[model samples]
Target: MPTIWLFAIVLVTGLAGFALARGRAVASAGGDTRVMHSRPLYHGLNGLLTAMLPALGLLVAWLILQPVLLDRAVVGAIPPEVLEDGAARSLVMADVRRVADGLDAAIAAGVATPEGLAALTAEDDVRGLLGQAGVALGSDVSPYVLEAARDMRATAATLRVVMWVAVLAVLAIGLGVALKRSHADYRARNFVERGVLVLLVAAASIAVLTTVGIVASMLFETVNFFSQYPASSFFFSTNWDPSFSGRGGGSELGIVPLLWGTLYISFIALLVAVPVGLLAAIYLSEFASKRMRSVAKPVIEVLAGIPTIVYGLFALITVGPLLRDAIASPLGLGNSASSVMTAGLVMGIMLIPFVSSLSDDIINAVPQAMRDGSFGLGATHAETIRQVILPAALPGIVGAVLLAASRAIGETMIVVLGAGAAAKLSLNPFEAMTTVTVKIVSQLTGDTDFASPETLVAFALGLTLFVITLGLNVLALYIVRTYREQYE
Candidate 1:
């Protein structure tokens, strides 16, 4: 909370600084001057950018680098024996911190000893020797725990005081400057507008940075996975029994069965969602009256707003049993609620609004001019819509469908409840089958061994799903871009 308050202060200070710089710049020009390319506001925004950019960058760098430096200093204080024994870095670090903490408590309680006191010794021999080693091999133990703590706290507090003072100082200064210049020729509005523009751009860039970070992290993990498991086994092996094998403990990695089940359920879901959703979109966008559209569009989209857990329960209690009795049992099939069809059907119902709402928007985007042109040629309303508008809007419709397919492939709850936990490859949708998402949830939702194949397999599955969705998104983008050319 203090950090947040500090940030707010810095932001306000920067904005005010910008506003002042802008007013000064504007005022320096002759009172009758109207020669600048942009409004005075742009100048103010530019000033804000200058003040805030370097300051914010410095703050972020300090936050990231401080922890690493402190950790290194803490690690250096451990005895040579602990360091030389080749223990895992994490375990060693944990022990060092524990020992240091013990010493601090002992020192406070006046119960220190050389053996027990070995952990928190500020002895010159230890400090000097560590410093020499660190200089020789970059492994110094700067005995500055107390000093570092004091400096860090003091520096943070100083920064806070500076931030608040700066904010109030700049705002008061900027307002004074602006008010002094507030004749009929003053340009306060221009300065404010420029500030708004810069803020919007900053907001947009955050989302872009986040997306890049996610993709980069996922890509690095996938590269590690491929190095461990052969691409052939991951992509083509039909079996997924990655049991603990031997003393060496490397389990086989296969993804084909998971992929098969994923595709099968998504296929069933699309088969149900496409016709129902597209028809609904067409009716809502083209056929429905204004009153019907206002009432029904929100109502249809409301299904999408329903939580997936609720849908999962519905699948488990209602749809799963109904399918078992009405369809599967009568067909001489196994009577399991947790079948591929049960999940797919329920998922399709959940996806109806996702498809329909998007399709409606794209369909509505079709120019009324095209409809008028068709009607002028004596085409009926149904034929005009079916033959002219739908084709014209096909790219957007296809994009919507692709997005829906990605959603279906990635869905977890419905499959968890209505698709059985069996990982068998099967042709019959009525037979139980598990999906990649379900398996990932099952594998990670408990006391998982990070080194175990069962747990690590989730990462591999995640990489696969990420790649597949990426491809679908790319394809959707391509279709949308291409279709935009048709109208042009």
Candidate 2:
């Protein structure tokens, strides 16, 4: 709900500010920035930025700080004895909140019993007497303590309401202002077009920001994890029994077996996905009739739309046993569908659209002029496609493959269901294997204490995955840039 509110507020502010600027500028004598400095749309955008930027900063700060301030005030009210025990701090706070809420509810309901009434009366009387004694006897502390407690409670409630009101008011004010300017001379089309561009850029920036946040979060946690477990052991040790004790009575947090499993399963998935996907893409792009493409493209995309969890179930219940008897047993592999092959194959099927769709787009985007030039040179369609079109689209093809690889590496559910949870560094595709994603899921899926290496290790694995994906994306961007030059 807060998220939805935040979005609505930001959008309203942006639109309102944009509209106001456009209106004021149009009404001015020399306001046309392009006709006088820049376009009317740019003027509107400039206003939007001015209005929303500072206020949104305040909104973000308020959102982050409100909970911390409330939590601290509530915690500070607890008695000192409860704070000394490690667990008592939490327990007493819960009880104190329950008592406060019960008091509020009882007072509201008019059902407060004699004991409840007596206890509250006693507390008030003691506080009042303490206050009078503090004033009459010239003691400086008792009245102040009571006053401070009351002030804290009231202030917390006030701050909560003010924050919500501020958020809603900002939204309502912004929306009202934007609507007020939607007149005939508002130039809505130009304003909307420019806004759409900004919106797209903002959307793209979130992906970059999300990647940065993940890396930064994992970096700090990984540092903590490495402090507890030596880096060498985590990277090179052949075992990955995180529940085991270290030589120094610490937890065993080695990663060799998990890394091995990740690579094996990913390799199998790539083996299954790449050739099939590439050939299908090649055929569809170069040979398929327009009618076939119309039918096939949507069907392939539908595969991508299927949820990964569904594929996981398909692997667990249907594919595992089928492979155990049909493939594994015949090949002298273990008779289990939860082998590397089962998950890898199903995951490969999942990734086919990823590879094919991207490749198709790149291949199709290759200029028709190049195809015509090859034809004019008396080259066959196949030859022209292989030599000219593919070469021109090579960088994009590589980018697509890299993207598919990243998807395969990060996939969790299918592997979790189809691959056995054995963290062994075995080369046999028929034997069950695990992956980093699977290990991360297994480690962090339940009620886990943050202090334990078992839980912290997931952050480390996440850091590794983030780094790998980041590297791949950067490489893809570079390749795409270089390929853009070829077409240009």
Best by TM-score: 1
**TM-score for each predicted model, relative to the true structure:** 0.71, 0.71
C-alpha lDDT of candidate 2 relative to the true structure: 0.73
- The RMSD of every model to the true structure, in order and in angstroms, is 8.7, 9.4
Q: Evaluate all candidate structures by whole-model CA lDDT and list the values in order.
A: 0.71, 0.73
Error of 2 at 20 (Å): 11
Worst 10 residues of 2 by lDDT: 135-144
The 10-residue segment of model 1 with minimum total lDDT is 129-138
What residue runs in model 1 are displaced by over 4 Å at the alpha carbon?
A: 15-51, 65-207, 242-250, 447-454, 477-488
Q: Tens digit of lDDT per residue, candidate 1, span 336-446?
A: 888999999989988898889999999999999999999999999999988999989998788889878989999998888888777888898888888899888876775
What tens digits encode model 2's per-residue C-alpha lDDT throughout 222-290?
987787778998888888776624223455667888878887878888888888888888999999999
Model 1 compared with the native: what TM-score?
0.71
